[model samples]
Target: MNFKHLSTSVIGLLVLSACQQPVVHIYHEGLSDTQRFQLKQQLEQQQINYEFTELATPDKYNTPHLLYFPGDVTEAYIQNVERIVKGLGFDRFDSQVFSHTGHYYTKGNLGLYFPSAYSERVLPELLFAHNCGDQDFQIHIKTNGQWTAMNSPIDLKGLDLKWEFYETFFKLRRYFDDGTFQQQVYQIKQHQVRTLQGYKPAVTYEVLGHRDYSFSLFNCDLQAIFAD
Candidate 1:
């Protein structure tokens, strides 16, 4: 979905919803397997200068730490991030957003995208169609201490992922009349999940909303906190 055009409006809404919290922007794109390997090398090599350890396995730093994330996220990618986060004794919190090629379930204030003038509810239904088989999602937390994001009481150590988007098809399938039909049906494939291996974690930060969603770290520096 060409959210680029709606970016401004969407961000404005999200900002309004969480006026008291900071915003930590994370940007990333999918990479091929070969590219991912190359990126990993680059990140590991730069860790020294960045004063951060690569979130890698084999105890690269010989530190005893745990990396936590939602099981819904691919294990390979999660492990990749875990390695680096654990290496720094950093806690990982993930609220897996369901995004497909055409549609996505990001922050609700960001709204949803669809081809036709479908109802707002259609957004979640299509975005999570793939996960419907499992009917769940999770909030993963990996922390050395029992610290939790305020107002978010589902202890981070571990919890079963569960989120079932309401399922009710539209009155009429609008594909016949909509050019965006194809995009609407698009989804992020399993292979796309593997591509995340190449991404790097940024500094620790917090993104506050009505409920604090602790993605605090992602593709960019999370250390930069800006309270609204």
Candidate 2:
């Protein structure tokens, strides 16, 4: 598409459409209000900026969310990509291109993505279990036109765990410090990936702690999460 040749104004519109931020809804379901408030206080204390909203009202709190939104991009990896996007002469609008650092929810490693384009990348299935002993998270990659599981995640005592998916030319897997695993697989053609019926990703603080959670299925071809 010769993205480099895109004009500044066109790029601005792209950035806007690609990186819209949404209100961070804090739900107190199943947990006491006190606990919810406590967690809320902690999040506020951590100084992580998020739109504070009550779950009771979905419409008033809803907003278009794009991966380019300030909070949406992992603080650990947004800077470099931001610089690149800026260098592209885009003044930050709807459609912006980014590269994954192959690292998720952790510092140093940055996962790149295009804010405006519908991506073929699918995050890994996140499973959560409280059995505190030893466990491993496994990831499978389609390489050489075959599917195979790479190294399992190192077991550790913690409530939250994660897995991530990204598009890459190579066939390989990756592990992160925050218990999240990642891998690159063959890119699916635009026709092959199905549209999700209803999908939304959110972050919340409960008695357990802060969590970045999401749910979606591309017509049952992929089932994924980032917790436990």
Q: Which candidate achieves the best lDDT against the true structure? A: 2
Worst 10 residues of 2 by lDDT: 211-220
Backbone clashes, each candidate:
8, 17
Which candidate number has the best TM-score?
Answer: 2
Angstrom error of the Cα, residue 168, model 1: value is: 51
Model 1 scores worst on lDDT over the 10 consecutive residues at 219-228
lDDT of 2: 0.31
lDDT of 2 at 48: 35
Residues 117-199, candidate 1: write the lDDT tens digits: 11112122112111212222222222332222223322333322222222221111112234432111121111111113342
lDDT by residue (tens digit), candidate 2, 51-131 = 443333222112212233334545443444344333322234222222254212222212222222222233233322222
CA lDDT, candidate 2, residue 172? 31
Candidate 2, residue 97: lDDT: 27
